[model samples]
Target: MLSVNSVLVPAEANVEVTFTSNMLVVYIDRHSKQVCLLPLDEKRQRKPKPYPFKVIAGLVEAEAVIKAQLDIPTYHLLEDSSFTTSRIVKRNERYQIISPIISEIHRYMFPRYGRSIVAQVAQKTGMQPTAIVRLMNMWFYGGQTINALLGDYSQVGITSPGKNARKVGAKRKNSPFVGRAITEQDIAKIRRFLNKYVLTRKIEEQMTLQGAYDEMLDLEYSTLLVAANGRKKVVAWSDDDIPSYSQFYYHARKYFDEQKKYPRQFQVTAAAYQKDHAGRTATIERINRPGELFQIDETPFDVVLVANRFSITGLCVGSPTLYLVYDVHSNLVVGIHLTLNPPSWEGMRQALLNAFLPKVSFVSGME
Candidate 1:
């Protein structure tokens, strides 16, 4: 880089920085004719190479002395008497006469004399382009662009264009279900099953690449829910059919436990084991209509969440006896409410009336 010692007008300063000997990416304010000195930072350069640099410096000094003999031959030609008969040296031939270019001279001088920029840099630098970038990025507006992307993701919530991508780094997170791949043998089996059942489930023509993936995730997560792999989140597969093994051992137990408690519906319960190929499982149970046979079940749940103590008249009860009226056929809960006191038989009749009477009145109002 060549420096100009002169200063410009009142508010302006011009600095000359030569990028290469020939090429430069110039920065200028044309109005003021001011050349801005861009901010440059040195990020912890590496330690010096002491031994080799010292040795090289010694070698170049030694070579310079011996090369003075070879240069003497060219000197006689310039001396003018007998040498003038041969040829005269011209300004243009000065460059052609010297074999080594300036860049090449720098390369040799650095290794030989410990003075070249590239040699000292290679000893103490990583990727040169990347280092140049890091220095430049700290200057004008690099961090702002990065912060904007992070801020945008926070504002619009995308996890690979999803929820909480910024906060939790969900793009880097492991998939909830990993082994969703359809293997060679598994694909053959799935293809066979697809022909038989895919259309029945309306998945034959409508399934997409991601739909295929989702189906696999559901089947896979269902099957390997238990067999714990060494990873805390990973579930191991001890059997040949990994999905079937995990499902039968882990999920089946839960299904059976659920069925035992609800004995009357056990035979007609939704089968979740469609992919496992063992017993009937309830995965895709088609829900019935909005309201049918009213279910009478009282569940104790916390009401403090929906209604604060001040709104509840400050009764100070932790749990409320919530009378939930659900339709047995449709599985739709018509009403869920908490009355102040413990419910009795008389309260039950009133609860039913309080739950259904509103609907009857609303329909009559519509009529």
Candidate 2:
């Protein structure tokens, strides 16, 4: 561990000690969250020494100079927020330049000494000097020190393509069961077992994947013991022929895949989930006038009606369907019609007439 005084050198000091000139300078590539530690020349440019960096987790045992610069404790670099507070990592390979291009900036004494340093380094590296200068000044400032160059690895590997990018996990392999000797018949049996015993059951009563596997093993044993009347005797196989739990579970999972469009499990139990959880959107139209837009729909009332008021025999029991019409702008009920049967053309026509006709003593005989 370095004492605070040895590692904390004054920026204005012109002393040329062996380590001050030969020691590695720690800088953080903010865009990459990379902590680059490379040797610097007397001109404050990068030397052709080996540059090594690790993710935040790897920084716990880093040199005291690096930890002090990054304001991280010796125990764990991750717990410190001074350097990592809000910095995010860019994950695209396009943003990642070769480490040489990045670490070599320490070798060229640029705008600090003179403009010619940038030109000298650029001509040697075959890259535009302007880009080099921009990268160097990106984290460089007077009295900034080496610590300002530490990248924030807390949010490294961010790849979102918008105003606010976010961190994401590395992608998984295509499939874990790729080399297995699974066949169509094995997959079919697994699907049938899931559909019949697992998926069809109520959510509360559904069997777990392990429970289903055990049951299938029991079924396999029973099949070998008992033979059907007309069909050929079931062949008994060695215990080695049986599929492993992981193999069985993998095939069973296909039926319950959540990524499927309009998944059957959700469709069947939609009523149990809240309607708002469905993430549906509704459109509200803008109405300028009372009669500009009209909305019409029909529904059945809860009460049963006796429709044989004038019948000579007896009362006829029936459910009455009610048609409702409303003005969209004013939200007023303009028309209502009641009929013993379900909604029909006649019901619609009567409802329209009720809306258009004037309700007054002069129009008493209109109905």
Candidate 3:
């Protein structure tokens, strides 16, 4: 039986001696690769999992052996395979916060959804997967409000990247909860419910402006009242989910019956609406004189401009007028006409008459 007096080394040093069994001891140094060991039959039993026990004692013994003879400085044992006490001890926590799905669709996630979801979370807080899973489970269980238990890891902390918002929203999502806005499937589900109950005939065939206003009321009224217009309040939650409007709107009549909180009192009035005349039968000419030369031209146009090319055939009836009046004396065009609507013969005639006004006087000196 080898005792402590026979094998024990000085303080801050290690020495190994065989006593009870064939257990190898290691030791720890101050730096990262630090390992320390003790005999398995140690008086100090290590706390159960992850802490380096036998390997560290073995290292310490090795260090002491070298120190007593060769006297070399002890090296840190952090990188040694013998130091594998915890299997996953060296992995990054940050890598876990951004899940695999985020990395796969980072390019296309923001465009369709509105960029307030995963992108926001990634940009904001360093919450872990367990936390996110817990939050989702909370939502699945009962937290239906979108603003459920938002900590520093939520919307308040991370603002969506505005420049990348489109791509983020457009990214494909397997689940509706992953996105900022409702998906087409959500809309389809609402339609299915509506069809099942024949809601179009009984409730609303087409959503009216008034109904839209009322729906907005039903969505916001309760929340706004609780928040009060001018006051800020702190709302808390443990586990929360989100209430989705896409699914709710199908049965909208159950909540709001066209009673608008924001009333639309539209009064139609006579006012001129501005239209672009760019590339619309442009009149390129120099007027030789007010009455001498008048040019009238028209171009077929389309309402739908695709790939920056407009249709020129009769498929489009919109004719933009290109009328030019030139002064004969200076050969400079004095009048030009362009209109978004179809150019009628009457409009052309009016344009010519306006160009050919009887006593139109140019500044006699400044010509």
Candidate 4:
């Protein structure tokens, strides 16, 4: 059977299309033998149209190669080994952001579901539908894998704030000072401020973007005024005297486009920072044998079971904790244990015993 991410190269020398088999089922009737093929191609539009699977099958039988069936090299294998740790981390982060969206729209990504599925998801998630669609398309075109999401960092060029006599960007509403133009000197000051306050390696010392902007204004543009009564006051600089916050932010992003860690304003928690930076120390080791490594975890199942199912007024029992042991090499579940009690040694022992023992038929009504 055709599976997800199966690349199909037609005999006619047309652009190759990847199959999204999850969406192949006919939505109108469940019993219908007629099914559609959700073929995605880079040159084709994002809209999913129903093409008869029989035609695709014929092409496959003739000469089309299901590339995924063969030992195709993955993104990690093809990626340059020269790439730095920071670049890899950034690519992973980008994938993390797009992963949730991909999962949300996986079944609806095909043409049979229509664009409304994307629109509905966008509305609920507060994301732009166009952006969501673009990401989806990128995933399909890039081999329907996380590696496809890695950005093209090959082109690195400095963007110069072109010399202008007057200020750039929209004027502030109801403000007399029509902002100062961003000069090379202003750009230099912005860089210094960003380095000192916003881009510090130490988390405790780092400042928010807005905080850094305020500090820049106070240090670089503020003036001390002395009145006739010998009273000294600090007068803030006008818009015309200093660069706007927008200008500062724009230059900061342009200059530090390849920043590994986000500033305080963008970071939600310390854990997020650790995930982006500190988490890279451990690399995934290649597993050669199924018995070489076994991973185990426990989670509360969604279902709740009662002490007695036959009684009308059965006490409400909480969800059972499910323990699973899986072979890391082949990703096959080796053992399982279900218990009403929370995670404990008993559950682990049972699961491990199940994994070590020979397989047997599980008959119903057996304790």
Leading candidate by lDDT: 4
- Give the Cα error of residue 218 in candidate 4, in Å: 66
Which runs of model 3 end up more than 4 angstroms from their true locations? 1-185, 189-279, 287-367
Alpha-carbon RMSD to native, per candidate = 26.3, 23.4, 24.4, 28.2
Query: What TM-score does prediction 2 earn?
Result: 0.23
Write the candidate numbers in order of decreasing TM-score: 4, 2, 3, 1
Model 1 per-residue lDDT at 45: 30
| TM-scores vs. true structure, each candidate | 0.17, 0.23, 0.17, 0.29
**Candidate 1 — which residues are off by over 4 angstroms?**
1-292, 302-318, 360-367
lDDT of 1 by residue, 1-367 (tens): 2111111111112122222111111123234333322211323432111123233224234432111111112232233343333243432232232222222432322224423444344345443533422222221112211121111112232213221112232332343432222234543444433333332344324443334434654554344333456443444343332333233224333533643422122234244445444575579655466553576787655464344646656545454577877777767667655665666665567557766766766557668
lDDT of 3: 0.37
Give the alpha-carbon lDDT of every model.
0.36, 0.51, 0.37, 0.65
> Of the pair 1 and 4, which is ahead by lDDT?
4
Model 2: residues with Cα > 4 Å off, grouped in runs = 1-283, 307-313, 361-367
Candidate 4 local lDDT, 210-303, one digit each (tens): 8889999988889988999999888887667778888888987887776665676666677877877564557879899889999998998778
Error of 2 at 129 (Å): 84
